[model samples]
Target: MKWLLAMLLLGTCTTALAQEATARQPEPNTRVPQGVMRYAPSGFPDRIVASPAQDARTGFSVAWRTDTTVGAPLLEIVVAGDSPDMGDQRRITATSVALKTENGSAHHHRADVDGLQPDTLYAWRVQGDRTWSAWHHTRTAAKASAPLTLLYFGDTQNKNVSLTTRVVREAMRHAPDARLALYAGDLVSGGDGEDDNEWGEWFEANEVLPTSLVVAPAPGNHEYFEEFEDTPQERRVLGAHWPVTFALPGNGLAEAKRTTYWFDYQDVRVVVIDGTSALDLGTAKAQAAWLDQALASNPHRWSIVLTHQPFFSPREGRDNVPLRKHLLPVISKHKVDLVLQGHDHVYGRLKSPPPVFVVSVTGAKQYRLSDEARRTMRPVAEDTQLFQVLRFDGPRLRYEARTATGRLYDAFDLVDGGERGKQLVERDEDRIDERACTRAETLKGRTDRCWE
Candidate 1:
């Protein structure tokens, strides 16, 4: 009996030790590598993306990343013809910048291809040494007053491989001729926004789509993360990959050019602002001054502003009052047509405005709206993934908000009133019912109750 009792105690000690060891181990799939370089050449170029230049008709920019083996950036383009001949085409060398990241050192290359004809189709590709990327075709924007359509998404920052992949795919499948893809920021899950695996997933997810799609993204708070040795006093900075990976227009003020820029497509002028840096680093004054100039100089008939944080907060205890205090006056003064934003993780549309403010999310993460927010905003959606398409032509701008599964949920139109202004025309047919909670549920300990 003594021997048996001793064996049982020994077994208990072993089990406890095993449990402790397991507990001490790091979480699975959470280990971030210090660098991502392989000894051999990573071969072909990756993350190939295009952005609208200061002028979209005759100018556009292309950016891509490659391993160190590719010392110089090269691109080849041709005015596509029925039987395009590569006989006289010349390859142009682009500007390459070395980017050393936790994953490894790679070169980010950017080329500004200019002097192309408006609304003309062209084929292009990037080359690394002798290896070349597949030929991709793109067309320049048509002259002002021409019809145009664009895809808009919000907060594609989580589960990019599984969820964002589906959302983007659905949007592209629905609208193959979309001229531009606009994101409201939070493009990755990593707090730093530069994680190699996270970026890889993003690139892979987008690879299946057309490489010519121009991306215009706003910077979110998640794009700025703290970096240090774990004690938490480190200052937050913009993600290392943000500027290098994207080649945007240089039409912004000092220090915030990448996140704060503007470009005109057809009759619409899109003004992108950097709300994260403004609220965190106290750069609001400079950004506001720049926004005033941008709006004042708008040559297009329709104006829209895009940012990560909304001017009006839609969730309880979640607000960006400082952002609003600085930019609302400018928006009002300019009579901005639309203010598109993300980070609320919920969907909301306001009826009141010189500017119609819309908050939406495309990722899987969600949040319940506060009572005040629900009561104030019309047509609020919860736990729904959405993508929006906006078409601008002549005297009308049409907007449709669709779910991930291609269901049209909300629709509206803005008609230009000539000397007066743009008037909102709401389409209420086949709209989904409001998904708000009841007051009775709130009385029974529910916090996300809806308004009557």
Candidate 2:
């Protein structure tokens, strides 16, 4: 039935024949022939993704990829109703670009849908000539201080993406109505970060979730990588796929446009900073200036900053001193609500009030928590895959951190204090014991072990 549905959707003439023809062509972008990337006819609208609009309440953007045969870039959206019909819909043409990936070549299309009514349900789909994707549905951001929920993830760098997929799927199941999905970098395991097959795995793992939920991803150290062979480690450049895949708001300064950006959703503002550009390219001053400006021009009552590197290092030997020194004063001066971050594969949350820093992991990668983490950060956990669901209702913000199996490990609430400060109320939840690597395990040459 599924095969029949696909054939009917593609039409008889273009279905099997197109797949067979495109399969025979050589994929020049990759060092080796990659079977994971299905070229053209088979890869129609495979990498469909969406992001929160620069102005979240009234706008959103989407991007997708297809083979060369589908030359025209188009998107059609209809206000969802009781009836299912394509006639009463609005069609918007998009700007198209031909991208040559390491594994193959495909056409990428991006469209920013603006002037939308707030708190409305809409269905949209993309097309390449005669091939059309099934309609996907999404809701715009609400204008008022209605309750809003969002999912936050840590580094997802893994060769096998099933681990991260399981956590993400469980998180979505837990909070099906989450408006935005925020990732704190390292979406893939490829060292150079331009491996198309790995990106294909990532897209396959994510499925259609990004198509509806707005994704705001900050690039970690892994996102910038050297070329396949000749490029040295120090010459690591931004992955080509990062810019083309996500249609993020380009409100960043100079060279940090897409990687370092921010947007307002509902009653809150999220600022995404580029730690790699600041540390690697000597752009800390520029990024810091932009952060000050972004925080200064804020109209929302709640402000949160998202960056790949944490201000306080969870691991003792792995310190991001430069990042912390450059950005901490700005964040402290602004009194940001929460600082969401990744990079340190352990889960560490400070016991302090507003501007609480949290470092967690959603993938299978594990790292030992340092002594400072265990003593300073309350309820620290090691070797645990976790996800965070944050709820904002006017002046109060509630955060719940759960493991992959849906166990609530930590819970806290922040109440707005107006001119004073936000009050941090912690919750006591009974969970598993904090785990660490045994001394025997550490003796076997594994450095990332926990100590009792």
Candidate 3:
């Protein structure tokens, strides 16, 4: 189960993790201490997560947490065949790190498994102190750009247990063979010190998805905080859990490291950015330069960029001008196909073509639309938790946005135009009316989620 996101591993998300620190007091936190302790790392491994290799065609990476008692945990992978058998399983060792957390001291292990055959089904598992997890499954990226399906999410920062879990489960049911599951950022609320139990909820919400698809994630502002609280040395730093939670490829600006990385699953290249660092920590210039370089060196037909902060906003007072200044120029220059983003906690997709910018939310949190969004985007929806399923076939990309209950809300197609970029072809046949806050809903004491 470690391989299947056995951590707080059950949930729903169709979003970009637009993790913004709202002025609202007391952020929504759904972590139950008992839940955290119930699955704490002991002899058994928890927080088991898998990330795609830099080149996913024939490789992948996995990470899991355990107690110190399991110093030399066992990892084995075998080509999925006739019956569950380890007779052909290949045993491998992992690099271990000791992580001290508020919950307790635990050991984290990472193993980058490569040299496997492409497009092959494989079963893997981890053995900790005294027990073993269920055999988890994963497939290597196809050797070439073939028909591919993927899932995208915004922030599930809050209400992962109550809301996001169902969203994730729904996505899996919707697209059983999705190769990659991309999270825009802010996977949890307390991406800081109080991060453990929150992550417990996240991992619990993400349950079996990790074992099957590439659990790709980017870091949102919430993923960082002043590690040293109430002290002179206090500074915004990655939470104690980020590094130990995921095994993302570190192929980006050294300053950003694992937080800002990318991977290629097939004919497409996904460039994930650390929007928090660019806007808050002054890594804008270098990060932008890197983006230009990443796209310039690309060998794929389409390039999609994923970031925690969006180039556009739906929340009235919120505008990420700084982020746009650094990131916009590069994305424009590259003619990227899709710029998927989160943070607005609302759904807004542009009516135009190439490099379509989409800001969506999958958690219970939803925001009102902004003046700018109304001016630039269409078919917008508010107060609706949504998920997106994207299908890439040769030169065409089908993008569909469905509500949490699986109702088609917005649908479109990006047709390849070669030098002209992708043409926006709307597919609203099954799309429903825009979902926004109603006066009746507001009168139900939901003023905070209205679109007045």
Candidate 4:
């Protein structure tokens, strides 16, 4: 009986070895195209953000990371049929330019997929020679006449991995059908590759939605890193990976490149500005001038502006006075419906004017609201992770601010255009029962502060 058992064990080991050998064997006409390593040659897959622009309904962009430097990695997209089953999928190929990071000097790959069906679902994978990633899925934007929902989040600069992930996941759970996501700014903790792990965590936390959700990001002060250099010209690097990671509308400030751009989704025209460039680098003239042109040329029924610094912040002395003076007139002139911003790490909505201005924070950190902030804004909250859900139907626009716990903190709507822009219709909804922090706690005693 012992002899028979030994023989059986030997046979089992032999079969396992044969299978392993077969799995390790390279495919014909390919280099090392066997085993799991063949699927991910570059181990560091990260910073995945997608954007839908140009012909938004039919086009999308994806940016991801790789372990080593390579020349222009290609992305393959497969449009899945209406059936959710895996057998009904068809694939197409596309390519994007490569970018190099400073830390570990990894290669970042970005690809823009266009000429797709409007409001269609697609699956995609990133690949290099002898290697390929798993297929991720995404849906295109709806047509102009169709009603759509979007998720909006403020700064995720601090505790991005821990706090921001919960808020983002909650937002997704609450609004699974949300078509697009708008990030006000400060998506990263710092630009100089500091807290690089935070970037990894942020990507990992949102991996479930990175490929599917259409993300639009504006630049913040934290996105800029000062490279070690003697001349002032070389010191500033405003978001090195932003342009490479997300395919956005390249039609903003002509000289600003990807920093400022605009794209139209259905009846809404969303404009993004690089407040960091305008404020720190003195590119305000160029951005402001181009903003005027972009706004003037737009023909959409609803217009929304996104930036990092709030023109009117709850942080007492932290108001963007120069930006307010320079840009508000243009926003007002163009009759923009919403102006979304961050950097205050608080939630504020000013409804006095035609263009409603909102500053909200969605990360772990919080700030105390000041008296000035309270005077100018309504439904302000501190020490809370908040996000906004926007629904657009014809001429009516509804917005809701909710906490991470799925509580509605603020709600409002806008109806029609023209002089009625200033007339905000507040809904009689239940405000989440939460305590308002005193001004002392909100400000943290820092009265004079600005993004350096």
Could you tell me every candidate's TM-score relative to the true structure?
0.86, 0.87, 0.88, 0.81
- C-alpha RMSD by candidate, in order: 8.3, 11.2, 10.0, 12.9
Kindly give the stretch of ten consecutive residues in candidate 1 with the minimal lDDT sum. Answer: 25-34
* TM match of model 2 to true structure: 0.87
Q: Mark the regions of model 2 whose C-alpha exceeds 4 Å error after superposition.
A: 1-43, 192-194, 227-233, 438-445, 449-452
lDDT string, candidate 2, 309-333, tens digits: 8888787687777777778889989
lDDT of 1: 0.79
The candidate scoring highest on lDDT is: 3
Q: For candidate 1, lDDT tens digit of each residue in 1-452?
A: 99999999999999999999756632212223445432212657888888888788987888888888787678888877677574555577888888776557888888888888898887888987569888887788998878988989988776666667788888888887888888998877675534666777666666645376788889888877876736766666887778877889988878686679998877888999998878877878888888999999998889989999888878788778777788888989999999999988888988684589999888766667877777888778877788999988889988888888878878899999999888889999877766543334322344453210
Clashing pairs in 2: 29-102, 30-102, 437-450
How accurate locally is residue 58 in candidate 3, as Cα lDDT from 0 to 100? 78
Models ranked on lDDT: 3, 2, 1, 4
Q: lDDT values of the candidates?
A: 0.79, 0.80, 0.82, 0.74
Looking at model 2, residue 282 earns an lDDT score of 79
In Å, residue 40's CA in model 4 sits off its true spot by 12
Report how far off residue 244 is in candidate 3 (Å).
1.1
